[model samples]
Target: MKIDWAAIGSVIGVSLSVTVGLVALFTLGIAGLSRRERAAAEGNGGGAIAATGAYVCFAACAAAVAYGIYLIMAKS
Candidate 1:
């Protein structure tokens, strides 16, 4: 039996990076939504932009999650 340390390390690094990145993106989406709500209460024009940004962030997070699922399923 042989252990490929480099392959193991790369997989761990990539998985951690993807996990953190998705979490950060989702957090930003939530923050943008909160800002939109605040702007709406303040009667401002910035809510539209914030809403658009929030949607983009949320979509990206969803896509990343779907892709991860596909990768796992593909191996089976």
Candidate 2:
């Protein structure tokens, strides 16, 4: 039996990074929305920018997920 340590390591690295990256992106989106609400209460007028940032982050996350699903379904 032969073990491909390099391939296994690469897969692990990619999976770990993707998982962590997505989580961080999602967290930032949530934080952005909260910040926008707080800023609105203070009449800071910065909520628009924050809301935009949040939307972009969320869209990117959604795209990544959809692409992943597409790739998986493509394999069949």
Tell me how far the alpha carbon of residue 27 in candidate 2 is from the true structure, in angstroms, after superposition: 0.9
- Tens-place lDDT digits, model 1, residues 10-63: 999998998899899999999999999999999887898888999999999999
What's the lDDT of the predicted structure labeled candidate 2?
A: 0.95
For candidate 2, lDDT tens digit of each residue in 1-76? Answer: 9999999999999999999999999999999999999999998998998999999999999999999999999998
Model 2: lowest-lDDT 10 consecutive positions: 43-52
Provide the TM-score for each candidate, comma-separated: 0.93, 0.94
> Residue 34, candidate 2: how far off, in angstroms?
0.7
Candidate 2: segments with Cα more than 4 A from true spot: none
> RMSD to the native, candidate 1?
0.9
Best lDDT among the predictions, by candidate number:
2
